[model samples]
Target: MPLLWKTSILLAISHDSNILPAHLQPLPSRGGHIRWNWIGDEHLNKTTDIIYMNASVAADGTLTGVSDFRATKFNGVTWLKTHAGREGVFAFKGPKAFMSIPGIVLPQDLKTFTFEASYAPQGAQNAELIRSGDFRIAWKGDTLSIQNGANTYQGSIPAVPAGQWVQLGCVVKEGIPSLFVNGKAVALLPGQSQPLTSIGNATLIGSGYTGMMDELRVWKEARPATRLGRDISPTWADRLLYFHLPADTKRSMGEDKASWASQIAWIRSRLRNPADHMVRLGIAGGAWKDMLRDPKARQKFAGEIASIVNRYKLDGVDLDFEWIEGPYKGDPPARQWDNYADLAQRIRKAQPDMCFTISLHVVCYRMPKKGIDAVDYFTFQNYGPSSARYPFDDFTRSLAAFRKQGFPDSKIMLSVPFQGTGDAKADSVRLYSDIVAQHPNLPPTADTAEFTYPDGTKRKMTFNGPATIRKKCEYAKAQKLRGIMYWDMGGDVRTDARKGQTDYRHPKALLPVINEILKGRR
Candidate 1:
């Protein structure tokens, strides 16, 4: 699993080939992985410098595939329990595990080429996961698509979620091939107009893989998704909190008991605050336009959010639909986005370990994508009206255009606005604690803030303070993304610097760098 970094163009071997390169040799696994096949697999010469490696050793040690490669044991692949400390391994029970790489060639000039990796699957078929000759890459069912001769790309592919650890990709020359989950490009598929001529002979990896896989590069050029490596979701590494509370847009919410004792004193001060990974605390509701297009109002809005989580024992709810992506305004288009994925599959059949989420919009439009993959997390509200500056390439090209439209930056998330949409021409949302309670010098550099209105018109405001929310939570924990959402907790309003305000608190400046880059994920 070696590739901590290195890819301006290429470099390979080491997702546990343990750095093989003396000519090559290492492949053996009946319970792990090793299907080998690259003996004369020509087609890797844009100034050739290949270093391929795919290791796995078990059935009684001593590597295996060495020359003109071709080994197989396939007990339906295995391995994947190591964490943070870094032991690069991943295999899946794919339809009887497979692999082959011989004569792999393709660059019949389709324009730009690319196909990075870090995948995770386990459902929906029309499988293949990877192939060479006809240049395939499957999952036609739950979506992660691509094909060659006579093309195959259905568009949006973000829900083939069997075990959920996406980072899959594709970038075939440009116009048509798009899908890329975790590193985020999300979906596009649709345009081939014909061009990619010579592609495979061999180069397959689990013809029907069910789950797990790691760092499988193959970039002829469009490369630029990077940020592989993920593993930390033991309920978000033990209690990654969520206090969203938006609902008060008027009624049917928490049906009252003084709003259920102020949401049980805001989930008991967010699990007794001072955050040592605050073990669970969700609520994020509002976006309730009569609970989207109706099926008995989405079964009475999932039975009033399952009776407010069995009447106040509440520990999770976040549906925040943010416009289920229908025809918008009062939504209705044939079941306003399939009745919110059938009300999150009946609220995951009534809270199967609740902690649901959904709040995307990086141009999602019609974005239901399997109803936010049936929940457990989803976010992307990537802010706006930042006067003029929020362009970190417009937030990484709207996260590579939401992974080209498939959406699965590992459960996805990136939202960014600690309040202050204010006067980017009267868009007005203001809440860097009321823009520092009337501009008392304000300038922690949210695109160089500014204020002067009352009609004197002199605006320019953004917001994110506290070192731009610790540099966007360290670029969403170095882009493995999946958690960093905060859209309106009253706009980061901790407020206390002697009332001159500006603390934008939200759990003391965003949970100490989101609990130090997610409890320090190795």
Candidate 2:
């Protein structure tokens, strides 16, 4: 892999060894020897140029040590080392050093470039083995692509056998770049036309390059290839066309409803047409039941729910009542289920346009068939099946069974456990303040009774760091799942509070990852 343009600072050290002390012998007959040392004074002599050893000089004349040995010169004090060698004689012990060429040509502005090249496997670690610019072309699986702006480029080549290499090259000229795989042109696009600027920094090798790259080159002038490279192939464009559903806020409970409503409002405010994005509000079925017990409370709750729906302009409401001590328990409570159904009917009558979703435990699948038909969408809390000694596969199959029973994919939201503990006790409710004080690692536990690992590792794990969460969101998009809904927002907010204690402020770490996932999906 080679960057489309290369920039570097090359330092040429020259020394003639006749001025050495006669008694001071060279070590082990090395090819050449030069010794230079510097000390400081009360004040530096501005007239004397500072000598740097194994340092990369920045644009400001500041010497940045690229090697382990480095010190600064203050007043008259200095740190310097001797250099001895002809063009390529002395063995260099550190990174290659370079000197910036003032007023050199620049090929492109600071804009990012995406090039298309044949996907070639870069082996296990996917290290870049080719001599390219700061960038190297390497493959991870079977394919690779470079993306920038509105353009994307991709290429394919004969699969390289293990221990073999593949040749891939791309060059930009006149607002267009051509990609060559095995010396044949495969893709091309209008490369942003710009001046050929001097690459003033050391080439970062294998940093951005993923796969294997060899024989990489960059030229001030564009060279013609035997084949014409085109834009991202139609196949690649088709792959990018896929898309994620709106996030479901069904499990947001108590104060969580307000937080979720705020989140939805925040998202809604940014959209040109809020209706374009799906918004699901959570209606506490427990609250509704409490209202039934107290008629006055029912009226107040109904008014509050209606106000919330109007205030947030919600698209739908997800009925999430755990039904912990309801009549539906022990034996089928047709009356209790009827009350719940009637509440849904009332809300639907009030907001005819709004969608209604009912969240149920997997056991709800055993409810009378008519009870299941009342809600517009069915959300299955697929978590916690392990409590019954049921395999995760079994839980997944139960959700699949709903689909088999005429539930549309769009009408189903899978509720994943935010609390990753396979242990039921781990999900035991804790106040936000308590979590802030104790700072227990919560959820997505790697090992615990609440969480069971595929490989049987028993380590408790939190949801993966932000990077892993972003990857999971991407996977969700790829899988075309309806959307992801977690049990509650308080736990996550509390986790951030604990982190904020040490840092003096709550970190916006999770927001960025979430926003990235929501990009364009809005």
TM-score to native of every candidate shown: 0.28, 0.34
For model 2, residues 226-338, the per-residue Cα lDDT tens digits are 32233212121112110001112212111111122233333344334433334444433223444444334434444444555576555455545655344632434555555
So what's the TM-score on candidate 1?
0.28
User: Cα lDDT of all candidates, in order?
Assistant: 0.44, 0.33
Which candidate achieves the best TM-score against the true structure? 2
Q: What 10-residue stretch in candidate 2 is worst by lDDT?
A: 2-11
Lowest summed lDDT across 10 adjacent residues in model 1 is found at 5-14
In the order shown, the candidates' Cα RMSDs to the true structure are 23.3, 31.6
Model 2 stretches astray by more than 4 angstroms? 1-281, 285-304, 324-331, 365-374, 384-395, 404-406, 422-481, 488-522
Candidate 1: regions farther than 4 A off = 1-76, 80-87, 91-95, 98-127, 130-168, 171-212, 215-295, 298-300, 307-418, 425-459, 462-522
Tens digit per residue, CA lDDT, model 1, 1-522: 111110000111011111110111111111010011111111111101111122111122212111121222334655554423324435656566765545342344444666555655656655576666666776656665577656777566556556555666676665357666766766554645334445345456656676666545444455545522232111112121111111122222211111223333332343222221111222233334454544565565565556555654544444334534446565555466666677678777766775555555665534557765777556566665544434455667777777766666676666555455654443554545556656555545444467655567666666666566567656755777565554432233334422222232233343233334434421
- Candidate 2, after superposition: displacement of residue 494 in Å? 8.9
